[model samples]
Every structure is written in structure tokens, then in C-alpha cells.
Target chain A: MNNSEYAITVKDLTKKFGDFTAVDRITFDVRKGEIFGFLGANGAGKTTAMRMLCGLSVPTSGNGRVAGFDIVRQAEMIKRRIGYMSQNFSLYQNLTAEENLRLFGTIYGLSDREIKTRSQRLFQDLDMESMRGKRVGDIPVGWKQKLAFVAATIHLPEIVFLDEPTGGVDPVTRRKFWELIYKATADGMTVFVTTHYLDEAEYCNRVSIMVDGRIEALDSPDNLKKRYDADTMDEVFRMVAKNAKRAE
Target chain B: MAILNALIKKESLHIIRDPRTLLITLLMPLVLLLLFGFAISTEVRNIRICAVVDRHTDETRAILERFRNNEYFDFQGLVASTEQNRMLEEGLTDAILILRTATGNMESQIIVDASNTTMAQAATGYIESMVSGQSGNSPIISSTLYNPQLKSSYNFVPGIMGMIFILICAIMTSVSIVREKETGTLNLLIVSPIRAATIILGKLIPYFILSAVILAIVLMLAYGVLGMPYSPASIVNVVLFSLLYILLSLSIGLLISALVRTQLAALIVSAVAFMLPVVMLSGMIFPIDNLPIVLQWVSAVIPARWYIAAMRKIMVQEIGIGFLVGELTILASTTAVLLTLAIVKFKSAVR
Candidate 1:
């Protein structure tokens, strides 16, 4: 595929800590307007790689381009063009939902009028108009998760990197959370998400299973299941992750 | 600039909503002012004393007699050498005067329980003065020049100011920053398109204003409540110097937040670990001269030491600006170094 056709193009990306390699020579491409799943067990180095891609951390070696900007030299430019929702889904608990959205909007350099207008639209779009002025802490975890997603995508970057956005929640809420991701992709925003849930991998247009700091398998869930001759994505994951000493 | 303003406003809301932060920011200075000013005085008084004398001499008798009459000593009467340790360990005596005479002139030692540093120092000091007065030779008359009344608050107000600043600016700032880190909000800020400097400055600006308000409150209490002398001549210098000190403390907080990974670690370091040096080595209560040689070296780096010294000169002595040159230079340079180090560490440590 042409480099410009991809929203994220990573070539031999690696990260090392003193004597141990955390993310070792991983290469992948994520197309625009697709929900891409990064699957790994605990300690599989998924978050480290995502952080490097998002410019929150520097890679030890290799090259990456996110939203058409070099990850290393153009980290600031890349940051401007991408949005991130960290593992915690960290909206300020003390702030009202509107305040949280406004804070993120303004940080993206949106004018006050723009922030107000867009946030109103976002709350409505998410069907979360009732949660606008309530403190985030006082809200349920499910609502907090949705608000955090809205905050991340408030500026409407070309790419949204979600680091395990739904780790702990009811199965019903998790399903609704995926709907938000679907809505974003429908708006032509690329979605890069990490989750340990094999069921969620099926929601992605394509998924990569990481083992021992490298991508052991990368394909659509149907293709991976077919290749592994497995009835479920869980079996496909276990088949590839069987060799991973790092998976805890 | 608009982003910074939003961040500051958001942070202000956080501070207002957080009871822990609000308590430390608002009520802490008042408690510390009273705690140091009246409750926990350093001016040692009415010490319990006993003596173990090996020789009976007119000189020794005179010294014991002086102790009996002195208002600072309780003069608990003579105890045998065998009872010396028992008296001290049992807490019956704050100090034991041990006098020995092999030659014509008697030599003496004041043995005190060294655990309570302030009490030990005071006990020994009173005994030394009593002993010197007994010796026929004329003793040097050294009276306090600045505070003739020798009120402990005169010394404590500056120290309270030092502590209040550290608690608010350093401890509170670090905790606030690390709270973001703990909640994972800091990573969001770090990943934002904005410069890291803007996020840090915005996070700290609210605490800076809180520190300023506390500074005003403390100064007013020191003058009105504690009856500290309000020297108009040096007031401007005091405020300016304190402002610089606040920045220095804020930088330390930034540096701490950068170094630590958790809010608990940041709180432990900034609140508990940092306060020990401020109280002990900063000459806040104990004179630096009385500190061990190693601690004196350690105190040289404590920003509060320089700040408290500058404050004492400015508030108590009403000293001229020329007198503060050394202190001002040290404080300003330390602030510069810490601010640079904090900014650099903040940028690198997050990675």
C-alpha cells in the first residue's frame, strides 16, 4: 500500500529499558477510517508501543509516521493531528463533564466559541447531554468512560489511540463503548485500540496479536481464526501466544 | 495563553473541590502559626535539674546555689553518682550536673538526655551560664540585641513562614501534579499538542496563587496575633524575597513530581521527608551552629535555611538591605538552579 494511504505506518519500531527490550522491532500499518485492534496479554508491550506512536515516549530505534508526520522529528506535529485516550480513561474526576470537555478542547487550541459549540454537539452526538454539568467523579464508571472518549476525540484528529479504554465495565457498557469507536471511524477517523478481550478483537477491521514484544499474527479476526483452524478468536490468540515467555 | 488560562481555571476548581488540598492550603498556615508561636516554644524554661557532685567546694556550692535561685532551673536537689543515670532515664531530671575535682579548680559536665535536641540544648545552655557566673572570672555579657524580650515567636514567625510556603508550594504542588499522574491525566497533557512547559506552568499557577494568599495571611497573623515587630523599612524586601522563595519551592515541587511515579511517593517526599530538614537543619528551631557538622553542610543546601535567615534579618533585626545581600544572592541563585533543573527534569523524566 502507498505510505500516504495509511493513517499510521511503523517500520521496525523498538523500545528498550536498560538491559531488557520492551517492544522489539514491531512493524505494522493501520489504514484510515478503520478500527485496528492491538491484542496482547499482560506485559505484551502493547501500551509501550502505543505510547511511542502517540509521541508520549521516544522509541529506542526505528521509524514511524502517524497522520503523515514523522514520529521522532515531528512528534509535536503528530500530537496535534492525533488524539489519545490513556488506559485509565482519565477525565478529571473533580471537573464537571462539560469542564472536562472544555479543558481538552481548549488544549487542542479551539477557540472558546468553538469549544462550546463542539462540546454541545459532542454531548448530543454521544447521547450524553444529561451528563454535561455533573462532576465526573460523581458519575458512574461507564459514563466516565464515554466522557473520556468524547474528550479524546473532541478536536477530531485523524487518528485516536485508545490504550485499553475498556478494561473493567459491565459487558453491556463495553458493547456501547464499541459503538462510540464505530461512530468515530464512520466519521473517517482511524481507531487504534488495545484490549485483552478476544471478543472485542472481532469488532476491529484488522487485529494484531503481540507476543514477547513482537507481532506474532496480523490479520482480520476471521482470517486469523481460519488460519489457526480455530472456532473462536480466543483459540487463535492462544495458538500464537503459546510461545510467549513474556505473557503473564 | 488561553490554554494556560483554562488549565489554571480547571486547577483552581480542583483545588476548591479537593478537601485535602483546601485544608492544607487554607487552614495549615493558621495552625502552624499558632503551633509554633505559642504552643511549641523553643525558649527553654523551668528545666528540671539535679546534681552529682564528687567534690565539695565553695565554687561548686556557688554554682548549685545560682541554679537554685535562677528562674530557668527547677534545681531538683543533689543526687548521688549512682543515681545519675536512674534520674535521667526515669525522666525525673532534664539534666544532671556532674562536678569532679582532682585538682584545686573543679571541672564540670552537664549530662542531658540527648534525645530531645531542643530540651538538651536548653538544659546545657542554662547550666553553662550558671557555671560561668560562679567562676570568679568575669563572664561575657551577651544579651539578645534584636528581640530584647526574647519571645520565641520572634524567631518562630519566620520559620512558620518558611514551613507554610513549603507545605503549600512544594508539598501541595507536587501532590497536585502527581495526582494528575496517578489519575493518568498527566499522560493526556503530555500527549497533547501543547508544549509540556505550558501544562506544568498551568498546573502550578493555582498553587502559586494559593501560596500568595497564605503568605498574606501568615504575615498578618505574625504581626497582629503573634505580636511580631512589623518593620516597615524591610517589609518590601521581605515580600520580594518571599516571592522568590515561593518560586524556588514551586520548582522543587516540580522536580519532585518529575522524579516520582506515584502520588503517595510524591506526598511522602514533599511532605514528610522534606519537612524534617526544614524543621531541623533550616535553623527554624535549633540554631544551625548547634547542629552536627554533617547537618550544617546539609543545611547549606536547604532553601528554607537561607529564606528563614533572610526573614529573621528582615523582620526581627529590621536590618538594612545591605545586610541581605548574601542571603538574597543564595536564595535567588538556588531558585534559578532549581527552576532550571526542575524544567529540564520535568521534560526528561516523563519519558
Candidate 2:
């Protein structure tokens, strides 16, 4: 229960779809209440690895735990402890925001009063109370992303896994979204996020750069820059990506 | 339990908001029932026939007159000889009846166009009855033929019920599942604590309820509107048969949904792969017994065929429950097997 305890641990985890190895023998750990960024190029297996840790997919081999539950033996427990906002648009497009939130709240098993109260309060907190009646498909993509994030975490899960959550958002909206992430982390929820944006990696407490089904670099943004003798995480990413390709 | 309740609620919202799905769910079955009941009929009626009275005798005219009153044939022209061939050839008439002139010691001969056999047979029989003067009152003979009463609704009611069940249960089940896939909500659910089985159940339960309601509506239409038999045996038989058929269709749909990545693909697969067997070999359009030996076995696996057989027995034959147990067993077992495979395959495929 200590704050410094590991919230997620993966040792030599791997996944293969037929002959294609999506996630190789990658090992990592996420401390409780920390923002852990998973960065990779398209098809670098970042989403695949995140999926395994979230219990959406079973690993071919290795061992892991999420929120102190074994990934192998207690995948359902792991799933219960995590919230996921997938890269693809996830919310029901035809439903109003209030209805969507109520449904997610119901899925989380909250009482009717709890769902009513929480949805009203959350919309107010997000400054989106006026848009609650609008269908999600009618709203801007940026707003939908933010609403999806809120819907994903309505259950107050211990860890929230966001896969490319800010893919198509404006810079200002992305910044606001990061503020939401920070707010959640501050409230003691661990943020396990995947993004292609290196700047987003800088906002994380630590990050792992995956290339070709393996993690080629893992450190804080400052540490990775210093270790690779680069000015920015982007440069460090390119260098590690080059070496990962060369090694393969 | 909470997650399931929430997910189900969310799904209901999607179904309600999507006007296309709402329209399909509420109206499709009833529309199809009405279409099949009132519009489509297999009984050949009002068929046009031309007769040639070569002798112009009173007896021959009496025989020709029978075709006018015959409900089966629409007697068109009573030409002497030249126009007989022209009428049959131009499609103005389905058959030509030629009464040959008699010789001193010869009986009069009736030559009917061999083609268009149903009309030929009806005309020929009417002529013989007139000649024999056998006018004693006898009961209408409904001897062996495909659907003896020529009741289109007798066969169509069951056929439409099967078709409706397939459309609502199979297509609707896959639509819900594929929507989840397309929107990436399925991934979210998979990653959540919800079991794959629970997700499948959630997708199925609504459609099942909807299909049951559809079945009830169709049954009422078959009985009340069409005046098809509505005995307890037929009603119970259709309900039970359609339920099993729904499960089979839905399971196949779920299996296809799991295999294919897109809703379009699921729709195509359901139509091409599932609907064909139900329509062709299920004895809805073509009788299974009349098919080639290999295809007869093929029809054996078609749940629609079994349902149609069970329906015909209950509705037309007025058979008791003992006659239906075999078909019912096949339907039930097939459903169970398909459902088990669907659940097992979906468990991994979604992940």
C-alpha cells in the first residue's frame, strides 16, 4: 500500500500473432501514482504491450502484475483495477454525453444516485455542462477525446491506460488533457499512457521507447537526453530507434 | 455485475439513437410477414388456357365451358383450329386443348398441350368428368402433392418466420458486436474486468428478446390475418422451432463477427453464407426431398429446413408432439453446438 510500491510489473512479456511478434521480451515497472509514458512509432508494439498489461490480451510468455494482482492468474482483477481509452474512437457516437457517462457509471456498478451526482459534477468540472445534451458525434473530436477520458475513468480505477488518447487534438486541448492527467495522478491514480508525441513523453515521470517489438530505451526524459548526449527526447528516440533497427 | 449493467445500458442507448436500427428492429419482421402473407403465393391460379372445339358440337362446348368455371385456369379464347397454336405460342394461353373429330367406330380424342402440366392436368380432368357424366357428390380430393391445399400461407408463414428470425437475431446480433468492434469500445470492454462470455451474453440477450417479440407478432399475423391454423400444437411448434433457429442464426452471426473485422463483411457473410441455405435447402423455396442426394444431406444441417419441416407437420398435417421430437432435437443440439463454438472462438478473437 506504500506510495513508492510498483503498480505495474512486466518481466520478459511477449505476444505473437501467428508468425508476427508484436511484443518481444520486454520488462518494465510503473510506480504507484506516477505518469509512465509508453512511446513508439506506428506498429512498434506500444499498444500491444499496453493491452497485455491491461489484460485485454494474454502474453505469450513472461509474468506481470497490475495493481498488485498477477496478470496471469488474476487478469480479471487487473482489468477491474484499470481504465482504458483506446486510440480508436470509443464512445457511442449517437448518445448524449450525460447518457454515455451514466452507462459507464452503471458498468462500474455505481448506484443510480451516485451516477447522477458524479456525472453532473464531472461535466461541471470539465466545463462541459452546456454540451451534455449534445450527441457525442456532433461534438468536436478534441471534446470527444476528453469526454472519453472522463468516461473511461468514471469508475475511479487505480490505473488508467490511455492509448494515443490525444492523437488528433489541438495543442491547447492536448495541454489541457495533460493537466487532467496530472490532476488524476495527483489524486493518487497512476497514469499508464502511450503516445507518439515526444513532448508528451517529457511530461511523464518516466518513459519507455519501443521499437520493433522491444523496448530500446527506458528512463526519465532528462536522464534519456543526458545518457544519449542529445538535446531532446526526440533525438534520443531517433538514436535508439536507429540502434534498435541496426541490432535487429 | 455493475459493468455489465452499464454496458447493457450503453448499448441500449446506441440502439435507440440509431434510427436505422430502431426502424429495422421494430418494423422489419412485421413488414416481411405482411409481404410474404399477402403478396407472394405459389398456388398457380387464373392460368390462361385456349380450347379448340373442332366439331362445334354441344357436348364439346359443354366440356369447354368447364374451363371457364374452373378456378384454376383462366380460359381465354375458344378458337376453332388456326389460332390454337398462336395463342399457346404467344403466351396468351398456358395450354391448348384440341378435341379431335370422331370417326365411325372411333372414340373422340382429347389432345392437350403436354407442356404446362398443371393446367394440362386440370383441363384434361375436367373434360373426362364431363364425358363420363359422373356427377355424384363426392368430397374434394386433396391427395398427395406438395402442399395439398395449395395454401401458400401454410408454407409461407413458417418460411417468413424463419427468415425474420434470421434477420433479427443473426444480422442484429452481428451488427451490435461489429459496432463495438468498429468504435473500439470492444477493446475497452475487453481490457476491462468484463469477461468475454459476459460481453457475448450482453450482445445476445437484447436481440433474443427482440426476436421473441417478433416471433409472437408473426405468429399472430399467420393466425389472425392469414387465417392459417393457430392450434396449440402449431403455435407451440413454431415458437420453439423459431427460438432454436434464432440461436443457431445468432451464433453463426457472432462467429462471423468474430472472424471478420467489419460490419459490411459480416452482412455479406451472413447473407451469402447463412441466408442461402435457409432459403434454398431449408425447403422454403425448394423441397429438400426433391433435391439431389448430396444436397439432401446438405439440407440436413440447415436449421431452417428442420424448422420448416416441423412447421408443416404441425400446421398442415396437424401432427402431435411425437412427430416433431426428432426435428426439435436436431434444432436444439445444433444450436447448442454452434453457441458453444461461438463463445469459445469469440473469447480469444476479440482479444
Candidate 3:
């Protein structure tokens, strides 16, 4: 993906809640069809900044465009063009998998027949087609995570935002979840993801680490590791975050 | 249109899937309606009364017979001797009716137990009308005490409005939002293309309709089944007050949900801090006028009180707009303010 293939553009995006700044001035761009990992810890402004990109929230003082729409003036359009999954594993536990899928599909303006066809295809693709009838609460956590991803991108959004999507899944399940993420990107959906998992960050085409509400480093996983003279993404994260805090 | 439909569908799922919210939303109105219909009533149809017939004359006997026939009184043990004091001191009955046996003067003296004025007044009116023709020129002097006329319905109508408003609006609203929060579906909605206004309206519309249904059911029971007077204007008053009260109640519910992360906390706060006051101080089951001065002032701040006041004015007194303008103004303004606050709080929660 070239510069012309940028799916999201951020210019000094800042978000403040009262006097405490949640996301300090941070800028980055996500290219089309690329798995962009947003790495940050708790209260590191990861969620806040993602919220801005998702168009669910506005930056306190910044200019940005998401999915080729102005963040401020075209938020509604940006919201329409993107999918989001929060760390809490967003799915209605009470409803059956089919009901949840149909709901999101319809909300995204899919017709009844389209929703029906898409839902059937989604269940088949996930290899848990029979689980569609079961209540989401009764399902295993791994399946729920994968279902969440499908629901988020059911409309085939140009850009999909995943906020720590694999927060508590087991290692094997997390690997399977990454496979689904890769498949989504292969279909030309831009994956703008946030996660605390350093290994997951390593799989990203490009990664940005946020600390104290600011992105301290942005580079390809290998380049970040090379720059910090570290063996792994985890060590690179520790070194950069430490230096970023010290600079502050 | 599509977004609104999605929200409605999601909201319905939340309401139906969560047992706690379903209980509060559907069962509350039914329970309160039954409780008020059976246990709480203003019309004293079978009030226990103790009457003293001073002289056992033919005319007086006939008059006493008239009293016995009256279904409103449950002629408790009668006293032929003039022991009015004993009748009341022993709590024998609500009031004592004295028929004078002054032979030459031919007059009737009716004394009522002043403690319960409503009973006294009703008994007084009955005796006066019964004996008026008994002795053509004789004078009938009746004195009433505590709550003369026993204006039970007058006290109940407004109280009903307030109680129903809290149950219908506030409890239902909070429970609905809390259910969404508990199920983790709120985030799903936030991710959807549904607009904020659409979300708020979607959650509120069903509860509003349900409130209307409750008002209709209770009103029908109050009038058709219970033999309470059916006032066309009062029915309109109930409907209008209910719509406004639902908005206020829903707003309170939304505010509670927004402030608290969990449904349990929202439920607790809404019940203790909101529902209790609207039920008690709104003067739905109790009279704010009789409450302490401080409580009376407090009642002024309770929108339910104003709603009840408007209901009472329209239904019981059959008063005109002049009687309700003040209460109506207060209720309307409070609703606007609460709704605005709720919107702001809801926005913050989403953020």
C-alpha cells in the first residue's frame, strides 16, 4: 500500500477530559489493506484515540480524516464506513448468534435477503454454522470473539477498528482469531487494531506504541526492534515506553 | 429509518431477554394497579359507624331504619343511651350519630367523632338529609371532626398519578438502560450506525406506550369495575400527565444507567433515591398538604406531586384550567430540565 492508499489520516489528534488529557497530540496514518496495530497499555489513550477514529467521539483539538471523510464535519459518514469491536467483547449475550448478525447487518442497511445470505455465509465461514441458533452466552469465548469480528465487519466496512479484541482468549484461540483478521485484510478491509499482546503486534504490517496519551514510536515491527536493539517486540515496547516516560 | 428500526429491535431484545428488566417493565404496573385497587381506596363504601338513638320513638326508629339501609355505613354496634364519648373512646366506630328525642322541641342533634373528619362529615350529611323531612319544622345541627367528608379519593387520584409515573417512567427507564449495559450490547449499539437521538427515542418509546397501556387498565378498573366516578376530563388529565411523567421517569432511569456502570447499582440508586421519593413525596399514596412543612416544600420540588395535583384538580374537584396551571407549569419545566440533563448525561456516557 502506497501513501495514496491511506485509509485513515491523523494530524495532531488530542482528546482531553477536563484538565486531564486522555490522548495527547498524536498523528499516524493507516494504509488501505494493511493490518495496523495500535499498541498501548491501560490509560495510555489507546481507546480514546481509537474512539476518535471510529467517529463515536471527537478529538478535543485536532484535525483528522477517517475513511476519506473529515473527522469533525463527516463523522456520520466515517461511522457508516467503519466497524468497531471494543475490549469488552461486544456482543449481546442474550440473543442468538443469528439474531445479533441480522441486527448489525440491518443496521448497516442490508436488505432482508442480503442479511439472510450474509449471515448464512458468515456462519459457514466461521465453521460454527450450527452455533448460530444457540444463545451467545452459551457459546465458548473463542467463538464469541470470532463472531464479534464478523458482526463488526458484516457490512464489509472499508476500515475495521478492533480494540483489544483478543483480550482474554487462550493462545490457540488467539491464533485462530488472527487468522480471521488476516482473511479480512486479504479481502481489502483495512485492519486498524489495538492490543496489549506484543506478539500480536509483531504480526502487524506496521505498529505504533502509545504511552501517556502520545504515540512514542511508529515503525514496522522489525524496524522498531532493530532501532531499540531488542530481540522481541515486548523488549522494544519496554525500552521505547521507558524512554518516552523519561522524556515527559 | 433503518437505524431507528435497528435500535428498536435491539432495545426490544434487551427488554425481553433480561428477566429483571422484564419484571420491572411489565410486572410493575400490574402489581401497583392491583394494590391500589384492592388495598387503597378513597370511597368509603362500608365505613363502620356507631349511632346513638336517644329516644326510641316511631319516627326515630324509622330514621334509624333509613340509616341501616344505607350501604355506605356498616352499622357497627348501636348505642340507645347517650354514651357518645364511650363509643369514640373505645374506637367502636368512625362516627356517632345522635338523633334528638326532645319531645316538645322535636329537634335532632348529630355529633361526630372529630378524629376522623371524613367519616364525621359523611355521617353528618346522611343524618341531615334523612331527618330533614322526619320533623317538618325541626332543626338539625350536625358537627364534624377530622377529615370531614373523608376525602379519600381526593387524596388518592394525585397519589396514583405520582406512583404510576415513578413505576412506569423512572423504574422502567433505568431498568431498560441497565439491561443494555449488563448484556454488553450497548457497545454493539455504539458501534452501529444508529444515531444517538434514535437510540434514546428507541429505548423510551416502548416504555411510553406501556405506560399508556397501564394508565388505561388502571383507569378502566377505577371506573368500570370499582364504581369510581368516570370523568372524561380526568381521563384526559391522566393521559397527559402520564406522557410527561414517563419522559421524566425515563430520563431519571437513563441518568442512573449513565452514572453507574452496572445494572445492579443503577437499580439500587433508582429505587432508593428516585422511586421512593416519587412514590412518597409525590403525594400519590399520602397527602403532601398534611405532611410536615419541610416535606410540603420538598413535595413542591417533586414533579410527581405536581402531576398528582393536576390529576386531582381535573378528576376529583372537576376544576378548570385555572386550578392546574401552576402545577402544569412546574411539571412541564421540570420535565424539560430533567430531559436536558438526561441527554447531556447520556452523551457523556457514550463518550
Candidate whose lDDT is highest:
1
**Model 2 chain A lowest lDDT segment of ten:** A239-248
Q: Put down candidate 1 lDDT per residue, B1-351, tens digits, no spaces.
A: 989999999999988898875886688789888988999876788889998888888878888888899898899999999999999888988999988876766888889888888888878877887787777575577787989988899899998888778877888889889888899998888899878789888977887888888888888888899998776777787889899999999998999999998888998998776788898899998899988899999999998999999999999988887988999999999999999999999988765
Write model 3 residue lDDT over B40-62, tens digit each, in one string. Answer: 76565666666676567788788
Q: Which sections of candidate 1 miss by over 4 Å?
A: A1-3, B44-143
- Show pairs that collide, candidate 1: none
Candidate 2, position A192, lDDT: 93
The superposed Cα distance between candidate 2 and the true structure at residue A238, in angstroms, equals 2.1
Candidate 2 has a TM-score of 0.91
Error of 3 at A205 (Å): 1.4
Off by over 4 Å in 2: A1-4, A243-248, B1-3, B104-149
Across all candidates, what is each one's fraction of true contacts kept? Answer: 0.96, 0.83, 0.73
TM-score versus the correct structure, for each prediction: 0.87, 0.91, 0.79
B184: Cα error in model 2, Å: 0.8
The RMSD of every model to the true structure, in order and in angstroms, is 4.8, 3.2, 5.5
Model 1 CA lDDT for position B83:
93
TM-score of chain A of each: 0.97, 0.95, 0.95
Interface RMSD of candidate 2, in Å, is 1.9
Per-residue lDDT of A111-213 in model 3, one digit per residue for the tens? 9899899889889988988899999899899999999999899899999999899998888999999999999999999999999899999889999999899
